[model samples]
Target: AQSVTQLDSQVPVFEEAPVELRCNYSSSVSVYLFWYVQYPNQGLQLLLKYLSGSTLVKGINGFEAEFNKSQTSFHLRKPSVHISDTAEYFCAVSAAGNKLTFGGGTRVLVKP
Candidate 1:
């Protein structure tokens, strides 16, 4: 079994400033990590994922995440955030052929 935890419940950042959303997981088996974003009144969108290969994974909208096996962490970062980046972010983990376990969402508010 696996569980995900998002460290922050809310993050506020100025527009064009760098931002990072922390995520951690616990599991006894290999798992896939994912980061999703949900804009206001919109469905979730895939930000990035760490399935296999390199530890550093890049995703849409200039977002990237580094998968750390030793720490069991996959943290998402954006060098510069825009007003459009304001949204709710979720961290998820799944074992092979199992359902995904999601962490409590983190809401990001971008200030001008």
Candidate 2:
């Protein structure tokens, strides 16, 4: 399956709690990985990306991701997430292409 996997479609958490959204991919060729966050009725913002080098990559809003070739995974992790972090996260892949094939998306809900 040359597709992306978002292990959780919906995740509810208390405010200022740690959260991890799992992402795995199956592809024969190398691909560019990306994590994007989208708020309600808003466009996507690039949370992070694993482009060429570096197994561990950091991005905006205190989010980071690790690229694993063997496991074919690039999981996103945040030590402590805020209420503003509540949004829809999408994992995507693009192998030398501009178009991105996104997962179903994981919803992160932060409770008060």
- Candidate closest to the true structure, highest lDDT: 1
Q: Write the per-residue lDDT of candidate 1 for residues 1-112, one digit (tens) a residue.
A: 7899999999999999999999999999999999999999999888888899999999999999999999999999999999999999999999884898999989999999
Candidate 2, poorest ten consecutive residues by summed lDDT: 94-103
TM-score of 2: 0.94
Choose the strongest candidate by TM-score. 1
Off by over 4 Å in 2: none
Error of 1 at 2 (Å): 0.8
Q: What would the C-alpha RMSD of candidate 1 be, to one decimal place?
A: 0.7
lDDT score, candidate 2, position 101: 86
Candidate 1 regions exceeding 4 Å error are: none
In model 2, the clashing pairs are none
TM-score of 1: 0.97
lDDT tens readout by residue for model 2, 1-112: 3689999999998888889999998788888999999999999999999888999999999899999999999999998989999999999998665568899999999998
10 residues in a row with least lDDT, candidate 1:
93-102
